[model samples]
Target: MLSSYNNNKVIYSGTGRRKTSIARVKLIPGSGKLIINGLPGESYLQFSPNYLRISCAPLNILGLHKEYDIYVKTQGGGLTGQADAIRLGLAKALCSVNPENRITLKSEGLLRRDARIKERKKYGLRKARKAPQYSKR
Candidate 1:
C-alpha cells in the first residue's frame, strides 16, 4: 500500500545540457521564477536578457502561464548557452512532473540539444569556409 505521506514528495529529477553549459534544475508546483546559484532571475537578467528569454521558454510551452519558480545552477558555458541548457533542463523536469507532456515537448524539439556551433577556421582560410585573399599572377 502506498503511504499518503509520500504524496507530495519529489517524483522526478533531471539534468539538461547545451553547448558547454549544464543546467541542474528542480521543479516544484509554484509560480514561475528562475533562481541561479541562489541568485534571483533578475540578477542574471542584468547581465543578459537573451538568457532570461531562452530559459523561460519551457514554462511558456508547457502552458505554465505563471512562472514555475525554478532553481538552477549552471556552469561551463556563456549566458546564451546556459539559457538553452536551462530550457532543456526545465523541459526534462516538466516531463518528470507529468509524463504525458513528453510527446508535446519532444515534438517541439525542446528535448534535443542543439548541435550547431562555430566551425574551426583552417590555418590558411580566412574563416571556417571563407578563403584567404587571392592574388592573381
Candidate 2:
C-alpha cells in the first residue's frame, strides 16, 4: 500500500500473505526483472521454473510482464508459500497501476488471497488434529 514518487519515478507497492509467508512487493517501471530480499529472484527461488512462473503470473496475464521491475522483501515462509505471496502482491501492485487491470486479474483469480493456514494444535493432540493412539489392553 506504499505508492509514492521517488525522483519523479512512480512506484506502486502492495503486500501479500499466504500461510506464514509475507511478501512486500514494489513495482517500478523497467524491464522485467525480479529482485527478492536483495537477491536476484531466479537464484533466490533456486531456479525453479514453477516458482518463477507463479510469481510472474499476474504480469503475464496483463501482457505487461516486460514493463515493470519487481522488487520484493519476503519473509516467514518457505519457497512455495513465498512464491504464492509474491503472486498476490504483484497482482495488487498491477491493479494500482491501472484500475481496469483489476477486472482481468480478479477474473483469473490472481487477486484472491489463499486463506488456508496451519491449524492451531490442541494441547491434548500431537498435532492440529492427530491424537495419540489409544491402548487396547
User: For candidate 2, which ten residues in a row score worst on lDDT?
Assistant: 1-10
**TM-score (C-alpha) between model 2 and the true structure:** 0.96
lDDT against the true structure, per candidate, is 0.76, 0.95
Please report the candidate that would top TM-score against the real structure: 2
**Candidate 2 local lDDT, 1-137, one digit each (tens):** 54999888799999999999999999999999999999999999999999999999999889998999999999997999999999999999999999999999999999999999999999999999999999999
Candidate 1 lDDT, tens digit per residue, 45-71?
575677677887767877884745677
Stretches off by above 4 angstroms in model 1 are 1-11, 47-50, 65-67
* RMSD in angstroms between candidate 1 and the native structure over all alpha carbons: 4.4
